[model samples]
Target: MEITILKSVIIDDCTTHRTVLKRLIENHPDLVLEGSYRNGIEAKNNGCEKNADLIFLDVEMPFIDGFDLLESFKKRPQVIMVSGKPDHALRAFEYDVTDYLLKPVSPKRFDMAIKKVQRNTGTMTGQSEDEHIFVRSNFRKVRVDYGDIKWVEALGDYVKLITEKKNILVLTSMKAFEQKLPENRFLRIHKSYIINLDRIENFTSTEVQVCGKQMPLSRKRKSRLLDALGAG
Candidate 1:
């Protein structure tokens, strides 16, 4: 059988830890490092295309944390946690990570994780396509569908999820809300705004009109947002 080619992204803060993880991933003949990021914000801010197969995510970073990074993408990639701290394993599971690797990871263990990743590719197919997601709101699990999500706006320590009929300002980070959305349907038009593509009526270079509400579209995101809407 031909060795399956894998594209990977590495995000971590510590230089030593990133170097170790890079060496480990490089040792595997089947895994290829697509990019390495020193921070979670840089990784997510860069955006994910359709082909990113896996992400070696760090649990902690400067502006945005690992879990937040995972949550920011509408299309969730198969993420293997790489952290110096072991206690973050439970938290990793909470974000539904594919695997957990503690710092100073051995090359052998890294190869093993790649093997597991290779074998599980079938199950990983379209894993993020499922639309319904449960978010903890008011100490209860609330079910929200992709269609119900109007837009996501950032707050100090939370994100405001405005639905068609109601608005929920959850006590969570923007990164957390980012992870819950479907990539094909949601577009982060600005650092402070992620709009549901399906809900938009029209848009301009500077703003998007969603449900009769005009929201500014960041200059950087204008093209991608248009492409996502099939307008470009």
Candidate 2:
């Protein structure tokens, strides 16, 4: 699977803060820094929001604020509001912003925000509720049906899709794969395992049986997994 890199833009009035954000955006493998603007007016005038997938916007800017700029966009992308004020959090969420990060962002918090973006917008370019997905295997693309998949296992940097017939290995992150799958049908029981809810024949507190294979179940996700399976 070829993961689609998110085209991101950074808009901030402060030069120092913008520099810090630019570094963070460039460091992320999945994000491609498209443009960096000093203010929302400059970003709007240059049409930076035209083809951007994500935006790191500062709420307080000279002349035009972040919220005003967001409202001006006819077609808005996913926004992660970076501001010093905690009061803007509630209002930011009202606009359906992906996340609101306080000033001087940590690497860990930035990663969490990126995960939220991945969950909201999948690696796939377009949005779809289709039953099938195409994955690369053996240097070729193979279409896999959602119903046919029994489970998914994380193997090093890749993930193995286990079906009734064969297990196909694809180069992709588990989080990225999880975003592609329907939550109702698939449940992540452990960090490395996502199982098909319908395929589970039996389960205990510590493990689940799918196609005669026992999969380890995490204590934290045990209740959620059971709830998903309707066995709680």
Candidate 3:
């Protein structure tokens, strides 16, 4: 199999930070540094993000902030946010960002983030994830078909997978469980719930119905859900 080289870009206000990021990206075998811009406007104007697969974006900028830059994206790409403070990590995760890194990023941490990007991009190759995935249920491994799954709900440190015939509780975090499912078919619609897009019966701005059960939808994720549904 041919390795997919991810074309990458860096948008940091500090020249030193941008340079450091460029070096790190260049050192990676699976990544290609397409452009390194000093700011969001610079990146946009230079057309650096076209056909780019990844972005290393600084959270704090003068004019267009990191989240604002994310909002302006023509198409969502894997974003690894760089920030000086940890205050934005939770919100950045809400955006479904690949990873958040503090300034003066270590080589080990950079590689870890790259691994996450690889995982995300690799799962997105096919049109659908109509395959079965196994889960640990009741001290035994059980296979669950993708079509059979309706939704997943968080329970403290664990997640419950709701399927047509039965529910299986797995010892995993929502974020970890979400990564196991294909992004095209399953999405984290709320902080506590991930729903199979194919199983959605109806959805308003506030909630979605799956398998005859209504689940709360985060207002922040409503637009993303609509986009996933290809709603016009």
Best by lDDT: 2
Best by TM-score: 3
Give per-residue lDDT, candidate 3, residue 97.
76
How close to the true structure is residue 169 of candidate 2, measured as C-alpha lDDT? 99
- On the 0 to 100 scale, the lDDT of residue 64 in model 3 is 88
**What TM-score, computed on C-alpha atoms, does each candidate reach?**
0.50, 0.55, 0.58
Model 2, 117-188: lDDT tens digits are: 775675644435576889988899999977679999999999999997789999999999999997866899
Candidate 2 weakest ten by summed lDDT: 223-232
The models' CA-based lDDT, in order, is: 0.72, 0.82, 0.80
Stretches of model 1 off by over 4 angstroms after superposition: 48-50, 122-232
User: Which tens-of-lDDT digit does each residue in 1-232 have in candidate 1?
Assistant: 4456688888888888888877876876667888888897677667742357889888878998888778788887777887766556545554656567766776655764664465457422232437567777788887777667888889888788888667776888877678767676688888888887645655556877776788988888876864443223
Model 1 lDDT, residue 112, Cα = 49
The regions of model 2 sitting more than 4 angstroms off are: 124-232
Steric collisions counted per model? 4, 0, 0
Q: What is the lDDT of residue 135 in candidate 1?
A: 73
